[model samples]
Target chain A: MERLMKIDRRLLYLISVALVAVTIFMPLGLPVKVSPLAVQTYDAIQNLPDNSVVLIAPMYDPGAAGELNPMLKAMLYQCMERGYKIILGNTNWTLGVAIAHDMITPIAAEFNYVYGTDYIEFGSKPGGSVWMQSAQTDLAGAAIVDFNNDPIGQFPLIQAVPRLTQEYIAAVLVLDCGTPGAVEWLQIITQGTSIKLIVGEIQMSVPDSMTYVQSGQYNGMIAGSRGGAEYEQLVGRPGAALKSQDTMSVIALMVALFIVLGNIGYVTRKR
Target chain B: MMWLLAQEQAPVPTLGIFSAGSVIDFAIVLGLGVIIWVMVARARTGRKIPEIKKIAGLEAVDEAIGRATEMGRPVVFIPGILSVDNPQTLAAFGMVSHIARQCARYDTRFLALNCDPLPYAVIEEITRQAYLEEGRPDAFNPDDIRFLSAEQFAFTGAVIGIFERERPAANIMIGAFYAEAMMLAETGSFQGMIQIGGTAMTAQLPFFVAACDYSLIGEEIYAASAYLSKEPVMYGTVVAQDWLKIVLALIIVVGAVLATVSPDSTVLRDILGGY
Candidate 1:
C-alpha cells in the first residue's frame, strides 16, 4: 500500500496514453446506448417534409471540431437519406467551412445529390447575429458567393430559398460551440415562427442548452459526443464516435481504479 | 356587408412613433433610468446612502498587491479575450483602472495582457492615466501591456508561458471568459499565486471558484468598481440596480401566480415578452 502511494505520476500518465492508443488501433465492439434526446433529434430530422430545404450551420472552429464534426456528419447522412435539399453554411466561423465541406462533398456524391439544385455550400460569412438577421430578409445579399466564390445566383438552391423564412426553409440545424451560435439562431431567425431550430451542442454546454429544449425553443438537440454516437446509430451510419465509446469506457474505469487506489493508500498510511 | 365595405373605404389610422407592443418595455426602461437619475442627484446633494455589503474578492485586491510588492514580483491582470464591445469587458475596464492606480501608488510592476487589439489600446491608455494620476508616470512601462493573440487557445498558451516565465505573485482575471478560464486559473494556482477572478460567464464561474483564492460571482463584478472607488454617485447607480432587482423579483412572483391561476391568461406573458 505504501509503495502504491508512492507510484510515479508519469507512470500513470503513460498507462492512460497506452490504453487510449491501443483502443484506437484494436477493435472493441462496445454497444452504444442511445439517449432519449438523441432519439428526439433523429426523429425531428427524419420527420421533415420530403424535398424541403434545411440549413446546416456549423457554428464552431477547430477547437470544438472533435465533438461537433461527428454530429454534423450524422445529420448530413440523415438529411440526405430523407432527400431534403441542403444549404451548408455559417457566420463568423471560417474554419468550419473547410471541416464541413470535406465531410459534405463526399457524402453528397454518394447520394448522387446535385451541387446546385439538391445542395449548396455558402461556406462562411462575416458578421455574427447581424449576418443571421440579414439572411432572414435577403440570403443572397448576405451571401453573395458560394464556397467556390461563384455567384450565388447561379445556384438553383439559392434561387429556390431566397431568404431564411418558413415559406422557404423548413428547419435550421446548428452545431453550436459559443456566442452567435444556436442562441442567436433562435433569437434572430426562428423565434415566433414555424421554422424549426435543431442544435448539436458540446458536452460542457449541454446543461445550458437544456432550457431551450424544455421550453420548445429548440425543436431538438444532439447533446454531445455521446449524443453523436447514439445519433449515428439511429441514422444507421455508425462511425468514429461509436468506436470512441470503447476507449472512453476503458478510460473511465482506469480513472475510477486510480481514485480507489489513492484512497486506500491514504487510509493505510494514516493507520 | 355594408359596415365592412364602409370600414374598408375609410382610411386606416397610422401607428404612433412608439409601437404598441413595445410600450411596456419602453416604460420599464424609462422608469429605471429616472430612478437612477433621482438617486444620483440625491447622493450628489450630500444625502446619506445605504452601506454596500462587502465583496471578499474585491477587498482582497489590496492584500494581493501588497504581497506582490513585498515579494518584489510583478502583478498580472487579464481583462479577458474579448473586444471592448462586451458589457462585461467595459465593467472590467473600471476594475482595471482601480487596480492600476493601486499598483502605481505602491510602486509595483503591473502587466496587462489582452487578446483583442481594441481593448489592448484602451487598457494601455487606462494604465498610463492611472500611473500619471498617481504621480508615477515614469513607472508605467509600454512593454508590459501586450496584445497576445486573437485565437482563444493560442492566447491561453501564451498566457501560460507568461505565468511560467514571469512567475507573478498575483493573478487578477476579471471579464468575460470561456474555455480557457480553467487553464489560466489552474496554472496560477500551480505557481502559488494569489488569484482573484471575476466574470459574468456562469459556465466558467465554477472553475474559478475551484481554483482561485477568491472569486466574484455574477453581478458582483459589476459592483466592484463602485465599492472600490467609494464614489457616492456610483453608489446611487448600484442602489438603483438593487431596487430594480427587487421589482423584477416581485414581477416574477406575480407572473408565476397568475400563470398558475389561469393558464389561458396571456396578460403577464404579453407584457413581459414585450411583443
Candidate 2:
C-alpha cells in the first residue's frame, strides 16, 4: 500500500500518454448524447430561410483551434447543406484566416459552392470591436479585399451583403474563445434586434456564455467540443469531434481511475 | 368640440427635462460621482478613513520582492496578454508601478514582459518612472522590458524559457489572461517562485488559485493599488465602490420581490434591463 501510494509521477505520465495513444488510434465509438443547447443551435441554423446569408466569424486564434476548429467545420457543413450563402471572417485573429480558409474551401467545393456566389472569405481585419461596428454599417468598406487580397467588389457574393444588418445577413455564427468575440457581436450589432446571434464557445467559456443564451441575447449556442460532436451528428456528418468522443470518454475514465486508486492507497497507508 | 379635438390632436408634452431613457443613467453616474467626491473631500480634510480589510495577495507583494532581492534573482512581472485599452490592464499598470518601485528600493532586478506592443511601451515607461521616482534611475534597463509575442502560446513558451534561464525568485502576473494563465502559473510554481497573480478573468481564477502562492480574485485586483498605497483619496474610491455595491444589492433584492409579487410588472424590467 505504501509502495502504491509512492508510485513515481513519471510512470503515471507514461500510462496516461499510452492510454491517449490507444484511444486515438482505436476509437471505442462511444455515443455522444446531444444536449438541448446543441439541438437549439442546430434548429436555429436549420430554420433559416433558404438562400439566406450567414456571417461565420471564427473569432479565435490557433491556441483555441483544437476546440473551435471542429465547431467551425461542423457549422460550415450545416450552413452549406442548408444552401446558405456564407461569409467567413474575423478581426485581430490573423492566424484563424488560413485555418478557416483551408476548412471552408474543401467543404465548399464538396457542396459545389461557387467562390464568388455561394461563399466568400474576408480573412482577418485589424480592429477588434471597432471592426465589428464598422462591418455592421458597411462590410465592404471595412473589408476592402478578400482572403486572396483581391478587391471584394469583384465578388458578387460580397456585394449581396452590403452590411452585417438583419436585412442583409440572416445570422451571425461566431466561434468565440476570448475577448472582442461573441459578446462584442451582441453589443455592437445584434442587441435589441432580430438578427440571430449563435455562438460556438470553448468549454472554459461555456458557463459565462450560458447567461446570454438564457437572456435571449444569444439565439443559440454550441457549448463546447461535446456540443460540436452532437451537432455533427445532427447534421448527419460525423467528423473529427465525433471520432474524438471515444478518446475523451476513455481519458475521463482514466482520470477517474487514478483519483480512486490514489484515495485507496491513502486510506490503506493511514490504516 | 373644437377645443377637445385640438387637445386630442396635440402631442403630449415630453416627460422630465432630460431624454426619456437617459435620465436614470445620468442620475446614477451623477450619484456615484457625488459620493466619490464627497468621500475624497472628507478624506482630504484629515478625517480618519475606515480601514480596508487586508488582502493577502497584495500583502505578499513586498515579501516576494524581498525574497528575490535576497536571492539575487530577477523579479518578473507579466501585465497579461492584452492592450492597455482594457481596464484590467490599466489596473495592472498601477500594480507594476508599485512592484517596480519596491524592486528599485531593494536594488533587485525587475523584468517586465508583455505580449502587446502598445502596453509594452507603456510598461517600459511606467518601470522607468518608478525607478526614477525611487532615485534609482540607473537601475532601469531597457533590455529587461520585452515584448515577447502577440501569439498566446508563443508568449507562454518565451516566458517559460525566461523562467528557466533567469530562475526568478518571484513571478507577479496581473491583468487579463486567457488560456495561457494556467501554463504561466504552473511554470512559476515549478520554478519554485513565490507567485502573486491577479486578474478579472473569472475562468482563469481557479488555475491561479491552484498554482499561485497568493491570488487576487475579481475586484480585489482593482482595489490592490489603493490598498498598497494607503492613500486616503484612493481609499475613498474603494469605499464609494463598496457603497455602490450595497445599493446594487438592495436594488436586486427589491427587484426580485417585485418580480415575484407581480410577474407582469415591467417596472423593474424597464429600469434595469435596457442599457
For residues B114-203, could you state the per-residue lDDT of candidate 2 as single tens digits?
Answer: 999999999999999999999999989999999999878899999999999989999999999998999999999989999998989989
Clashing pairs in 1: none
Residue B106 miss distance in model 1 (angstroms) = 0.4
Q: Tell me how many clashing residue pairs each candidate has.
A: 0, 0
What digit string (tens of lDDT, one per residue) describes model 2 on residues A71-148?
A: 899899999988898899999888888899989989988999999788899999999989988988789999999999
* lDDT, candidates in the order shown: 0.87, 0.86
Model 2 CA lDDT for position B117:
97
| CA lDDT, candidate 2, residue A216 | 89
User: List-wise, what DockQ does each model earn?
Assistant: 0.16, 0.15
Across residues A1-271, which tens digit of lDDT does each residue of candidate 1 receive? 9676767878999999999999989968888888898899898888877677899999999999988999999999999999888899999999998899999999999999999889999989999988998998899999999999999987878877777877788899999999779999998888766678999998888888999999889999998888889999999988877878888889989999987898799899999
lDDT of 1 by residue, B45-142 (tens): 87766667888767789999999999989999999887788878877888888899999999999999999899899999999999999999999999
How many angstroms is residue B82 displaced in model 1 relative to the true structure, after the best TM-score fit? Answer: 1.6
